[model samples]
Target chain A: MPAINLLDKFSRFSDQWSPKVIAELNGQAVKLAKVQGTFVWHDHAEEDELFFVVRGTLLIDFEDRETVRLEPGELYVVPRGVRHCPRTEGEEEVWLMLLEPISTKHTGEVEDARTVRTYDRL
Target chain B: MPAINLLDKFSRFSDQWSPKVIAELNGQAVKLAKVQGTFVWHDHAEEDELFFVVRGTLLIDFEDRETVRLEPGELYVVPRGVRHCPRTEGEEEVWLMLLEPISTKHTGEVEDARTVRTYDRL
Candidate 1:
């Protein structure tokens, strides 16, 4: 039998930044999302955020002159307490799985227009 | 800049079962692989092992008569102390990243045909 497609699961929903809970491990939530354009600059003070890209591209910009572009199948672990912003180039849609504490906020510290209120599940 | 491709990183080595160390976080090792055929049944007494599939499929057969099939982009976390066997159904190659303690063994208890030696780096 074929297993679940992470992107297909995201396609079932339309909310951005509101990651859907997929799996859990040792108290950490594994979330899948379909993201486009730019996300607000924020920081996860208590936990590191892992961005594993499944399709398209993403550029993670940190506050301190650190900018990393993620390609398909590449994963970047943003350490806890670092300020960062995410943006997508072109018109590509990105598939991402974030591993972190379940209570992590969609936007940290700076209140902005892109903060996701609630997380949805598929 | 484009980030490192996990599968391409595995292409830099030719060892089977012997996983190559990739990134590290909070003292945890993230190792990637290109696997085919079957892996020896094993159990990690302390740390859970996460298998994130990048290409093709995998059948994880557990000792309790339970089986879970994983496909591309789907991740499965094998809880600590659980014995399981992994097998590929066809000639397809599979990409995996195993997250566990650095001291964990490739094989659990039973002396098998697929015990890997020392881990490699790419």
Candidate 2:
């Protein structure tokens, strides 16, 4: 089978902060997510999340009061146990690949309002 | 800190078949490998591998007699336990991001002649 085209699959989804699994390797799940506005303040206590700007801009807000602005073609890792919230302005959408386990929730903490159980494939 | 720019780091390396650790997400390692010529046939028995072509072209040959050609700005995942070999012709270099564990070898099997310890960062 042909390799999965992440951008092509991402174009099929319009929901923000909803991440979908694109592929999995070695127990690590590669997820594509659309982001606008701001995500919840949570930290992956056991796993570091990778953020790749596939389309628009993404700002990774850290617990240290630092924000890393990511442009297209750029990627960053939010270290394990570090609190962060991602945000972008305007109507532009940000495409990201979160490398974690399939069991990982949208919010690392349980019972959050934005936590999603069933993932959508786009 | 700014997000890691994969292409920028790839520009610093000119050697072929050398994969560098760019970042680690969760328990999985994100590696940047420069590939040319042919790699040894192998398969990750424990984890699936992800290949994102940042430059040049890459051909993934599978044990099932299938071959997938990848171009720049494209990505593919080699499923776990699937035997495969990667190769490229000409002087063109292919930049790839391998999402596996730090313990995973270039050639998945033990006692391989092409195996290298201690990964370098580009």
Compare the candidates by lDDT and give the number of the best one: 2
lDDT of 1 by residue, A43-118 (tens): 9887777788877888899878669988877888888898989999877778787777667777866787767667
Candidate 1 residue lDDT tens string, B36-102: 8888778878767778787778889988756888877677778889998888977777777777666
After the best TM-score superposition of candidate 2, give how far the Cα of residue A35 lies from its true spot, in angstroms: 1.3
Q: Which DockQ value does candidate 2 get? A: 0.70
Candidate no. 2 TM-score = 0.90
Question: Chain B, model 2, TM-score against the native?
Answer: 0.88
Model 2 misses residue A90 by how many Å?
A: 2.8
What tier of docking accuracy does candidate 2 attain? medium
lDDT of 1 at B58: 81
